[model samples]
Target: MGTLRDLQFALQLKIEELRQRDTLIDELELELDTKDELIRRLQEELDRYRTTVSLPGPSVVSAAASAQIEDKQRAARQTVISEPFIPDAATLAMGSHKSCDKNQKSSRLIKAAFLKNDLLNLNEEEVRAIAACMYHTTINQGCFVLQEGSIGDRAYVLEEGRLDVTKDGQKMRSVEPGDMFGELALLYDCTQTYSVSAQTDSKLWVIDRKSYQTVLMQCGLSHQAHSVELLRGLSFLQSMPEDVIMKLSDHMKECNYTDGSYIIRQGDTGDTFYIISKGQVTVTEKKPGREESIVLSELCERQWFGEKALWGDDIRTVNVIAVGEVTCLIIDRETFKDIIDGLVSDSCEEVQKSNASKIKPDEDPFLVSSTLSDFQIIDTLEVGEFGHIDLVQLKSNIKHIFAMRVLAKKLILHNSQREHIRREGRILMEAYSPFIVRLYKVFWDVEHLYFLTEACLGGDLSDLLKDKGNLDEYCTRFYTACVVEALAFLHCRGVVYRDVKPENVILDEHGYAKLIGSRCMKKVEVGKRTWTFCGTVGYMAPEIILNKGHSISADLWSLGVFVFELLSGGLPFDDCDQMKIPTTTIHGIDRIEFPEIISKDACALIHTLCRSNPLERLGSSRNGAKDIQKHEWFEGFNWDRLCNKTIPPPVIPKVQYPLESSACALYGEGSVKQCMNWDDF
Candidate 1:
């Protein structure tokens, strides 16, 4: 009986052990499933790259796909060049081996480089002199490390787990250990080039500029010793200064016509040069047997075409068609000329002799000219209870025309209110670009305060949004960047632009947009943490409407709504009163809804911008709207292409003077309080 019991006990122990093994397997499977889901999401973002094209020309491989192919080629080239780094066969034949202790020490060193951020504050000789600084932090799965629009200051080295880099919400790759990402932003000081999300719980080290500079000063580092390293290091050159790379990158443009597409035809005089970004295009000559199309080149990614006719004043060399989708970048002749001119001239280095003669400010050298001393009466454009704008001819033609905005006396009774108005004027002036009116002077006349700026002849963006049909992504990108840059500049100064609406955005002839004078006149309560609900109703972000503390992100939200109006030719959320009779009900409140028709990129951008949570709004996230700028929709824009230079202004067709009468109606009525402006102040 005892022997039988002992055998039974042993069987019971075996059964329990098997059960434990099964549970372990189940847990492992669950973990694998979680990891897979993270990978899939990352991959989904990568796939968003499909619609990306080289532009004008179509291609067999999408831009994202081509990038992958290039990466593989570069990787293979690296392996071949690095073969010399391996131990020699003679060493192996000698039976020499690395000790386990040595291997352990090496592993520790790698781990120290990969899993630490304490290095950020330390500028040690080793870290500082090494030309690459290592810093790391942990990231959870689904967290995006890098995003499109925000500028990048560092390049990351993946230490553990994986990451996915995406553009336009598409995943470009599953980057894993030993992979480096975000070098482009660091190299250029421009916005983040792509969005990066962790595919798993990740550990990463980022090499920042200071550390990198420190490393480059090393005496041991030389071009000959690190030729392969140099190439890898220079991968960051994709973000090189636009002037340095534009010509070479321009050479990468491929131009071709698919069967259905038109290549240039007769009598088109506009200047444009096309380079194929992808695919084969056919050229046809109409003489005899030549009538049939002949393929000049099977233009794939990186192939150059369309230069001979563009360089000189030549007409179309041959009629062309895209055999397939052709992707190409079309450089307008004017812009091309501008670039070539910049290259040939030393204008960037040569400042005018007149500029050097001016006295320099001991501090804040950016302060150019001082405010105007006096001004005579001018023709009033609009006078209201809040403020007024006047059309004024400055002292000289070189002075240009200026608009004067005066705050209403009633609104400035409170000393705090007067101070707030002054601050707001500065903020508003900074929040818009040169496309908008450029604020040149702000001061107080005897009876009136003045905010003066360059006048735009074309009128406000609100009118354009309403009158023009739906705006395309191309136009929206052009405007959004201008406004965002304006906002960024304003925010950096610690000024909050509480008011952002379509009515405030004025357009110039060159399609450049600007913030008009209305923002300067709005009433502002001093010492308040947040402004009152001041913006036009439909354009206000929910947070602002709720009187939550407004910030730079508020302007971003307004921009989203503004873009929606531009694209849809109407508002995203319509006025309830507009529909006298309601159709659908939400929480027993009847509502009307309309189908949306806009590019997916615009829609996504709007959705992000108009989020109810201010934290999630565009430019407020960890990475922000920089990612939005990098979307596939904005593929062809050379961001550096538009900075600090005068853009070809939007084409304003000849409209009879007094546009308000032609489009909707021209009428204005408002009252100013009894007290004079200076007295109220």
Candidate 2:
């Protein structure tokens, strides 16, 4: 009996050991699955990079550069296929490799030289200490050193060999030995702007975010003092706080210009403000009807120019020439504006309070339909010449999606432009059509005017055309019918849509067309016409091009051009030289040669609608949109169903219930604000 009991116990022990082995096997399989998924994602990214880099065009990349790129692509593929760095079971369990102190002194030397340009004030001891904290590593050729959009933790100094740098899959430049890359990642915990890949076997020294921040903190006081000293001499920046000056310095870049180079030219759009850091510049103005430029002022180091552009139209009023080899610290328009806004917020507390009180219970009837406090801005969808279109949601219990159009009040307040804004608001409110983007409300604060309207997730027809090339006849007819109905509604209401093109037509989630852009919609009496040399280059009507009086007929001509562009992949009269478009437009539809691929019926209809004489245009006749609707090109089309959005659309954009980032321009988290004072609006 004792022997039998001992044997039973041994059997139980063996079963327990087998169960333990099975559990280990299950865990290992799960880990392997996870690694496999990671590898698949990496492979997809690599493929996309290869495809974008290999796109053929002389304009895109030189022949020699193209060959080099192809060779790199092959090397990368071979690396992936032959020796992919897959983590083994033991390595996975242990995590990443430990950092060693090998090659420390050499790394310190490389880092010092690499950071010399950016951190000019760093002493040898400070630079060595920063380098001592970095880890040294070597990678084989075709390895990705840093990837764009990846969470960046470290900056690298190349010790040996070359690396290629790319942004959005386009090669920007190459980094040679002793050069540093990925410094921006050290400044903030943001995604990398560019990808760095090893073009050959490379050695690098990398510093993590923690070490970089420590160094910056240690040097902060001196950096701030240096920035403030540089900025104090400038008149416009004199009132700025030390912290603001320090922040501005972070965004500023040093630019060098040779002698006699034009820093800025009169009548050109100014985009950057400059502070002379190391040389002299001369500001000049052209005397009326004179060839010679009169020197207004000669500016030396610490002096500035281009401040007026930040506050207004940004049109340069004077010419600036580099007197010698000049080095300037430059700040772009957006950065300057942000800095100014911050300073204004800090200094203008009293102004904001006064403006707050000025907001009475009663306001302009056309401007305020609902209080500005009721909506929350989600994200900026698009930036326009006059304003920005933002994705917004109602703050009420039932969340509603909407797009808020915000126009700068300063731009609208100009004497010549004020009427245009007023008219746009009025027309949008009065003109109600399903085919047009519906306006829910209009309001304004001290700094900006706002229009709340429906959000179109499918983007614009122009973007769609670019993606799909030219559309099929059925798809073109479906979209055209929607536009025709919208135009018919506008014309009958006595509103002339001066701008009519693919950009002006937006597509909803269901792919239905909606006409937007109220700026060019003007109300006119039946027989009268308005003369404005406005509208896009390629789509401009002959009457508008010739400066002849144009009314609703101009919209018809634009529509015809738009249809042709949609049917053919190219524009009817487009040229590389913009100067030639005006002459070509005035030469009229007779010069338009239709591609053989376009159907005969479509060609005939385009000719009828794009007639040079407004009276002879198909839609401009007594029958109006009815004549175009009955044309052979749109034969058997269901106009009523299309208008009602019951007809199945050719394309439907993928959308989530509230919204998706793909549908709009994504701003950083916390960049958008729900509440704004009158001054900040």
Best by lDDT: 2
Model 1 lDDT vs. the true structure? 0.49
lDDT of 1 at 286: 49
Error of 1 at 170 (Å): 57
TM-score, prediction 2: 0.44
For 71-90, candidate 2 gives per-residue lDDT tens digits of: 65333212000111123345
lDDT of each model, Cα atoms only? 0.49, 0.67
- Model 2: lowest-lDDT 10 consecutive positions: 76-85
- What is candidate 1's lDDT per residue for 587-627, written digit by digit as tens? 11112233356776666667776665554565653233465
- CA RMSD for every model? 25.4, 23.1
TM-score of each: 0.38, 0.44
Q: TM-score: which candidate is best? A: 2
